[model samples]
Target: MNTRKVYLIWFFLFIFIPLIGSAKIDDSHIRSVVQILIYDNYSKEYISSGSGVSIGGTRVLTNYHVVEDIIKQPSRFLAIICLTQNSQSTPDCSYTAHAYYKYGIAGTSAEYQEELDLAVIYVNNKKDTNGTWKSIADLPMSEFSFDSINPALYGYSMTNIQLGDEIQTLGFPDYGNNTITYSNGVVSNFWMDDGDFFKDHDGVLAIGTSAKISHGSSGGAAFDKDGYLLGITSAEILDGNGSFLSGVIIPITTFNWWWEKVLGYEIIDGVGYTTGSISKEMFCKILYKDYDKLHNTCVCPKGYTENSNQECIAGSTPGSDVKIDNSTSLKIDPQLTNRLKGYILLQVQSQGEAWYVNSVDGKRYYMKDGSTAYEMMRKFALGITNSDLAKIPQQGEDKAYLSALSNLKGKILLQVESHGEAWYVHPKTGIRYYMKDGEAAYALMRYHSLGITNADLDKIPEGIL
Candidate 1:
């Protein structure tokens, strides 16, 4: 071959090859994809199944099964279309479907049966000024010729998945909850079975991944590496070990006949449409239900009242009289001794019991019965001495006094003697006096200091002294 001919062939091949590779959908396109949430009349609750692809201007492409019954039984079922994005961060957007069209059920018993599971619905905007119902745009449909199966299969597989891909399957399982449950797994296989479609009596099986599929995931969309709409995740086979064998996905080509006949549009080359900003209130209502009947529980968090199907309103303030009993002792950290002291002082002022010592982390410390503050200090290895007790000044009259001050200091070391009233004579200071009683004999307690004003002492009952 001539050099000029070879160079021309190479240039053509490079351009065409890259275009072929670019034909497949990627993950970025899938983020705009959504699942269909529907209310089931039989269960009397919300359920979800997959279908998605935001074509443009809020229009979406989805399967018939996802929105079928809701369209047929409007009063019994409502549709909530969710756009799949970062489910953890971005809240799932929900739109009430306003209109829908079904295909492939014509002239067959399967039409009325469960098999013709394909349909497209227009999602309703919560706030439409013109009152005209809006539909999410369809995904760009690629052309496929049945004669050339290899290229068609390759295109579908590449669009459907990447090796080691982790994808979610959105579906309504038998439990019948409205929330979308995601099952993630890697792509295990990709193959085509011309006879398998006829055998299973469905559409073409162009791609297969190992992601889990349940009773409700029949119409969900499978996104590719760049998050683009690739194929519809359909079914799964389970083994005896409770493990999923393979997930079957129908390629976009399966919808080609319906797209042309029902939708009446040609496949275009471009990104899918976008929708208007979803309302926060509408979004919350569709994504989460306000009532859960099975458990007889309200979906709203505690302290909020259910305002609607999916909303909550702030309720009245909690009753102040509903007191939580503090019968258990709270332990204090030794390192927070000053804080504990302040807490004890406050409790004393409030006439509340400063019943126990607690650790910083909230574990309680207990003291033995008949243990005084001095005895407790000794037990905890504080080494408080006899001389320290003698320093406390005496007060009041001699008949009320119980002993000489020096001997009283030694008596205070005994846990049983330290609590309650005691009369002590200060022999060296020439003063006879009295000491006040506490709650219990030998209980560790803080004494009212001599500096305590007479007014404060008068507040105490005469009998309590």
Candidate 2:
């Protein structure tokens, strides 16, 4: 049945190829776009829905309004990002991503809502069969440069795009949830002032289009000739007679301002991992705490506690006080300095004892021992390589316990254990810790921080035999 739908979609594309007379739509980006499912927490059911595009590794950009309610009360809502299977319309893989960071929609006055209607969401990776964080598919990042000092990143776009130029939009229209829908139209007009397009909009530039944009199309990408991206689909403009006149788009330039102000990094090249995305070593240094990406600092919001795992969660628990090697004060937590300084460095500088190592940027920590370091000592106390530290076969979750201990005793041997963001093993002598760990650790951390009490830690993949 789905095969027929796919065939018919291609057939329509072929039939309209010459008649549409617009920029050639690049189907190569099909994998980059995804359908979003929004669910209200109390009802335990899907309430609203929309579409999104992967802008970075494990990061999706969608309309801030689409997830506005969730941002206000994140504990009451959740979003799932689904990767569509090519042959079928149903999701082949889905990850629960959240609006960990956002901007634009500030005051409560319902006067201007469209000013900065953008948001950044994060997708936690699934553990591979061997318990390593497998790299999930993401959309390619734009190569356009923004700043000379940091470098700007943008998608494909025509130079000095003018009015009346044709556009091809790709997104999951509400009418069709099985496959991505495409529409072609020309830029009919541009709104210089924010509210120029609509009386209720904020002060920002918007493009008016004659394309057929439906309700669920918000947050979808709008591309110009040669498959370069122009802006994101906002909504439709209605005439005084309640008729569809034209579609509206928030220009990519405006989004750049929000991206820089919040994320503090550039996706110079569309593949955003080099600097834009977070890494495993950096994850450990940051300690899985709920942080404001805008300032690139770890911060726990009001009413939430950062567990030993460094995750922000509801309620409170005794301080696990996870260990941090070599740092007299919290001022320069060497554990958290990867992107700027460099990783795994140790030297006797004039300022007493000091060492610096870049510990940020890598895959999420999995039990398979992907070479992330837990502690930087005068010398690695254990001769074992960092990779070997994780090489030991991970144990089952049932055998593990959650505790803060000064010494390793009474805990199950080889059994994985964690308190907050950090996982550890009590070797009957001095304990050893994994900067990150198996699915059990991930679930238990979320179990506390996200209130996912129903999570079955046993189902989490076990790395060790």
Candidate 3:
């Protein structure tokens, strides 16, 4: 080949090759990078701005300072801007959300030796005008190192990485107008032991990347060559003229350590995302009980009760003592309702989203879930009828008080039902037990008022029990 042709080809490759690589990185991850805009609830004005990375589910991990106002006054005066659309262009921000205080944030403090300036803000569930849910893109799950937090393993292990290994970083730098900003930099320092991010104490390790972390880039992620999140970019040390100098990063290993200490779950290899989908069969097993269909094994039987040998016995019948006359008048479609059938009516009136055969009129009663339904039948059964339901703390009212009641379960005359979760008295001791409302049919819960007497046992022939 001629020297002129060779020079031209090299020049084209030099210019276009980097551009292609940068474009590919942005294309794959721009959606997962979120721009967080905070606001004051009372004044209805904009607060400070920063960036966040979705660890998964509805949770966004950002610097604690980013949502500091929220941590101070949650459910009092705080609002969050959620990017519900593709954030590549102008992010399609949805209806302002002050309702998210319920979901809450974790680790919002300047403590942990200022080492933990991290917070995981939870985005609340909201529906748009079309009744569709507002969704945010989740970052790909990245594993954490379980070996140990050290400079040698993280800073200089990979063949492609060295002491001053070049790294490609992306974040929402306000200088880039809050759009996804890309910067090429190198590993500046590894603070696994003798490092900065602290003045005195030999605190936890941190990463110092030379990436251009501009304003609004706090809590953004730093990725490696293969797009694995290495750490989170927190701050940058600037020169007197306010020019960028060195950036301070919190390694993903730091987060993994904190998460293990606090949340008690491991996130490496995508084991602890919490929101990852599971099959319906597995779903029934994990939260409520244990079940594996392959060997046809479960902790309890199909009827959800154990036999003399402690083995699960399937298809057990309801042992309701009484029966109601003309029960057919109270029958309803079993497909739409979860009420147990053929059980005798227990109360005069019933409430919640279930077909109820009223002992008073013998007519079917249907009410929304969570209201006052099973209070009467429970009263008759255990004398825990009225004010006790009012006194027992409802879920989310006082978590601590209910936690205390758990230890007293045996001492108290508590009747634990599946879905109907009112405090029923222990006909003997009369102590209260906080029953978490569940929907296992074998337990005869109050989620849907299955009347005292089973009227339509045949209507709902099949159940998860």
RMSD (Cα, Å) for all candidates, in order, is 30.3, 19.0, 17.6
The regions of model 3 sitting more than 4 angstroms off are 1-23, 76-88, 95-114, 130-161, 194-204, 271-465
Q: Which lDDT tens digits does candidate 2 get at residues 1-465?
A: 111111000011101112247755433455556666677778777777666766644556777766666666777987766655342456533456655422111111111123357765655444344646432221111211111111123422223666667777867766675467878887766655633332222334667776767666777777766565677786775555755666777766656544432222344344321233334334333333344455444454332355453344432332222223555211222122212122112122322111222111211112121221222211111112133234333454333332333222211112111111333333332234443334443232222221111121111111111
- Top lDDT hit: 2
- Superposed on all Cα atoms, model 3 deviates from the true structure by an RMSD in Å of 17.6
Which residue runs does candidate 1 get wrong by more than 4 Å? 1-31, 40-44, 47-51, 90-94, 99-116, 127-203, 240-242, 261-263, 272-465
TM-score of structure candidate 2: 0.48
Backbone collisions counted per model: 42, 26, 18
lDDT of 3 by residue, 317-430 (tens): 443222235452222332322232212223434332353332211123342233323332332122121333444444445423444333222211122111223343221232
Better of 1 and 3 by lDDT: 3
**Candidate 1 C-alpha error for residue 56, in Å:** 3.6
Go through the candidates in order and give each one's C-alpha lDDT: 0.37, 0.43, 0.43
Could you estimate the TM-score for every candidate? 0.37, 0.48, 0.47
Model 1 C-alpha lDDT per residue in residues 27-125, reported as the tens digit of each score: 333354455656566676665554454443233455555555665576677666654343343325335553322110011011111232444454543
